[model samples]
Target: MLWVKAFHIVFVASWFAGLFYLPRIFVNLSMVPPESVAERARLLLMARKLFRFTSVLAAPALALGLWLWLGYGIGRAPGNGWMHAKLAIVVLVLGYHHACGVLLRRFESGVRQRNHLWYRWFNEVPVVLLVAAVVLVVVKPF
Candidate 1:
């Protein structure tokens, strides 16, 4: 169980790295001038690879987290409201990950519906989510 927890922490941190970076790539992608075809292609390739790797990391992270929660009953006891809160944040993180994929698709399809400023703002979302998740887990301030 200790090993599981350690691995879970590692994978979670790795996944969060992707969550933090992919949007920054989007910011760069959005700012790429129309004439910079080579640059756009390069950023798209990086974003695509990062998204795939991040998704792979997310699988182990989620599986290990579920193991800790259900198999080991880490937070199954009564009044463990912090776990529930953390779960909600996890759901939001998943949604955010999906949104990144959608945005990437939009970029791939040559649809520049959003500007760089929007992506700059988007990049901060995972940071806040991570902070909230850490607080819920460590502080358990419910």
Candidate 2:
């Protein structure tokens, strides 16, 4: 149980780290002036590298999380409200994570003319989702 809890903490923290860093990357990318092709390339390269590393972290984080849940959670606490809510939020977070990947690829593909403002607005989604996730985990509001 202790090991499972530890893995939960570690992986959840890593997931949050990725969540935080991704938005900052978008902000940086959005700020790059139109004329600085070289600078844009550098920023894009950095973003790609960061996302790649985060993607690597995400896989293990997700795996360990699932292992912990299946191995420790399901039978241990029957009809757990918070756990159920957290699991649902996890799905939403995963969806957002995949969306970020699509956006990353779009950015990589030189597909300009996207609604930058809309993408910037979309950055808030994860923040709200993360907050809800934390609340579900910590507050356990049943």
TM-score of each: 0.99, 0.83
Please write out the lDDT profile of model 2 over residues 8-42, one tens digit for every residue.
67777777677667756766666667898988798
Give Cα-based local distance difference scores for all models. 0.97, 0.75
Positional deviation of 136 in candidate 1, in angstroms? Answer: 0.6
Q: What TM-score does candidate 2 reach?
A: 0.83
State the RMSD for candidate 2: 2.2
* Sequence-dependent TM-score of model 1: 0.99
lDDT per residue for candidate 1 within 1-142, as digits (tens), equals: 9999999999999999999999999999999999999999999999999999999999999999999999999988998999999999999999999999999999999999989899999999999999999999999887
